[model samples]
Structures are given as C-alpha cells and as structure tokens.
Target: MHLIIMRHGEAGWHTNDQQRELTETGRRDVADVAAHLAESPYRPRAIWCSPLLRAQQTAAIVAEVINCPIEEKSFITPDDDPGLCLDALLEQPPASPLLIVSHMPLVGALATLLVDAHRRGLPFMPGEAVVLDMPVVGPGCADMKTQFLP
Candidate 1:
C-alpha cells in the first residue's frame, strides 16, 4: 500500500489554535505539491485530514488535484499517537493509496514509525509530504518512495 503523510502548510497564530487557517503562501505551496502528486502515479485513493482548519484546507487542495474524497478525522490532531493512526489505517482495505493531512510531530512520528528501525523519528516541515510503500503497517516495514519538502 502507498501511504502518504503530510504536515499542514504554514499557518499564522490565531486566538483559537484549531481555528488557525493557512497563510497565502501555505495555500500556494500545498497546491504545488498536490499538482505534482496529480501528475505522478501515486495520487491517493482517499484522503484523511485532521479536523483542524489548516489541515482541512490543505486536504481540500490535495483532494482537488488528486480528485479524491476527503474525510475529517479528529484523532489526527498534532499530539495523537502514531500507533493509533496506524491502527486506523490498518482498518482500511489493502493495496490502496491513502493520504493523511495532519500536523507536526504526528506526521513525523507516523513516518518514522513506518521506516524507523531505531525508534528515531523523521523530521518534516510544514507542507512537507512523504510517500511510503508498505505491504503492511509495522516499524521499518516500509520504504520511502518519494518526498516533497519546502
């Protein structure tokens, strides 16, 4: 299966953390990244995004390019555990690409959990996207297929 995990684009500080929206540059950067994904062979079949405003906005952009549906998942919040996320993913059918638009530390954690044999996490910037091919969900059981960073 192809698992694509991404961090939401740059967002400005707002009074409400969950209400924070993406900046202009964030929209553009995510669009560019999504466009590239649309042109590739790895477009996701489904997209799961955090319920936060920033993540939903980012997911919308990606959904447009990938022509896929988006589902808001509250458990994808920044501090959520990578194990739970993986379990959620495991509930899906096999052999389909899934895109998860979430936040930091969670994004990095999930990515590392898939590829890290040493329990060290990978770092990803805002608007960064990593694609992994995992036959199954397990630590160090996948390969990083591609990445887009800004």
Candidate 2:
C-alpha cells in the first residue's frame, strides 16, 4: 500500500480563523498538483483530509481529479499529534493508495516519523507530498518510495 501525505496549500492568515480558506494562489497551486496527480501513475484509492477549510478545499480539488472519495479525519487537526494520526491510518489500512491532506507540523511530522522513527519532527513545505510503501501485515512499517512537490 502507498500512503501519500500532502500539506495544505498556501492560506490567508489574515482571515477570520485559522481555518481560513485558501488563497487564489493556493487554489491554483492545488489545481496544478491535482492535474499532475491525474496524469501521473500514482493515484489514490482514498483520500483523508483535515476538517480545516484549507485542507478540505485542497482535498476536494484532488478528489475531483483522482475521482476518489474523501474521508474527513479529525486526527489531522492542528492540535492533534501526527503519531496518533499515523497510528489510526495504519489501523484501517486501505487496499489501494491513500492520500492525506493536512497541515504543516502534522504532515511534516508524519514524514519525518516514517523516514526516521526516532525523530519527532515535521519538515515539509506547503503542497509537498511524500509517498511510502508499507507491508499490509506489519502496520506502521513503511519504506520510502518517492517524494513530490508542486
């Protein structure tokens, strides 16, 4: 199984709440990312996204291109721990590819955790994604496959 972790696109911090929607640039960037995924060999079977507006919007666009159902997971919350989210995802492993649309620290932290279990950190840029191949029998056990940014 392949897990694709993506960070939400650029957002406006001057908005009402942290859940502020994505900017026009953000939308464009996500659209380009979606188009790339649509034409690429890697496609997601299921997509999990944070409830935040920005993250949801990004997932929605990607879903349109990939034609996959989106599952809103609270584990991607800003305050939520990435380790917990990773555990939950591993618990209910998807048969096909899985895409996760989330915020910075969580996305970054998840990538770092997958690459180096001892490292409790997230170092991902916005709109960046990391792909991992994992064994079905042994959950949480993954091998880094590829990483992409758009």
**How high is the CA lDDT of each candidate model?**
0.86, 0.78
Name the 10 consecutive residues with the lowest summed lDDT in model 1: 87-96
Off by over 4 Å in 2: 136-140
Would you list the clashing residue pairs of candidate 2? 108-122, 109-122
In Å, residue 34's CA in model 1 sits off its true spot by 0.4
Evaluate residue 145 in candidate 1 and report its C-alpha lDDT on the 0 to 100 scale: 95
- The C-alpha TM-scores of every prediction are 0.94, 0.88
Report the lDDT tens digits of candidate 2 across residue range 31-74.
88878777766788889999999999989989998899999998
lDDT of 1 by residue, 35-57 (tens): 88888788888899999999999
Give candidate 1's error at residue 13 in angstroms. Answer: 0.8
In model 2, the Cα lDDT at residue 49 comes to 94
User: What TM value does model 1 have?
Assistant: 0.94
The superposed Cα distance between candidate 1 and the true structure at residue 37, in angstroms, equals: 0.5
